[model samples]
Target: MKERWELMDDSKIVQLYWDRNEQALTATSDKYGNYCITIAKNILGNKEDAEECVNDTYMRAWNSLPPHRPNILSTYLGKITRNLSFNLYKRNTADKRGGGEVPVVLDEIVDLVSDTDDVEKEIDRRELVKAIDDFLGKLPADKRSIFICRYWYFDSISNIASRFGMTNNYVSVLLNRLRLKLHNYLLERGFEI
Candidate 1:
């Protein structure tokens, strides 16, 4: 039996959720199960943990949809999967530590912002988010995509370089320059960076 929703578009699948239809979950899984799993696996590095996170992503989407309709469903699901996987990774570290691009991703941004004695005293968390959003908005499209791919998706430099048809060294340099620009922008905004 062919799945009907398999032929449905993302917006229609999202609408099914808004209408409180259980088939929405099936549709979502059919369309994005592997994509979500890949993201979770990349971060958690455990198949069982990644599967659990992907299941949790569906539940979160179910709860959030009536109130929050995502313009880009895949990105929304990927973000939830990534976060759940990270939390699970943090929880499981005492028993077992799984490794992937996360450590490299963290290291790449280690010195991007200066460690402040009191960042909250200088700028509240909401304000900091806004500043970063503004800074990203001001960036060129390619730079913004590079930043998001590296930080948000935790993609490796080599992957990003291949995606953009650039050398690894060039991608690394571009990201470094973008981080410097972000650091300076934050400092200029009185972020105490």
Candidate 2:
């Protein structure tokens, strides 16, 4: 079935959400729920937490739509789910005094950059986003998904391997090669290394 929410205009969707129409909720879920869940599951690494995050995303969307006419509802909902999932993951890690896979993935990138400098200011965010889009678009779909799962989603190597039905060593090699390619691409674009 086609996504009803995507078929409707953003304003109508926003109004439906604001009115708390059950059909609207159903349509929204039908359209974006799986995407949101994937984003949350990739970050949280727990089905229960991901499910909770998806529900929370819908609730947050319902409450916020009246005042926030999001230009891209799917992206907005996905961002909310990802943030909530990450926060919950952080809380769980804090409780156990254990850092999770997501944190480790972020640390790999963090260690490559200077802390005090505003990296965003060095390169236009839009340009960087466009560059990333172009870079991913050039990859085969499977490799692109692998790249996104590893870096964009911050999934652990093992997790990505399992999800993609590959060996951990294979996932690691793929990511390392992709990282090197991306780094070279960025440098060639004159982004500060």
Best candidate per lDDT, number? 1
lDDT of 2 at 23: 69
Q: What is the C-alpha lDDT of each candidate?
A: 0.86, 0.76
Candidate 1 residue runs with Cα over 4 Å from true position: 1-7, 112-123
Separately for all candidates shown, the number of backbone clashes (residues 3 or more apart, or on different chains) is 0, 0
In model 2, where is the ten-residue run with the lowest total lDDT?
108-117
Worst 10 residues of 1 by lDDT: 112-121
TM-score of 1: 0.84
lDDT string for model 2 (1-193, tens) is 6645656776677778778786677777877878887778777777788889899988888778777888888778877887888888888787874344677677655523332346765555556677778988999999999987777666778878998999999988887788778777867886665
lDDT of 1 by residue, 71-178 (tens): 999999998999998898888875767776787788877765555547654656567789889999999899999899888877778889999999999999999999
In terms of lDDT, model 1 sits at 0.86
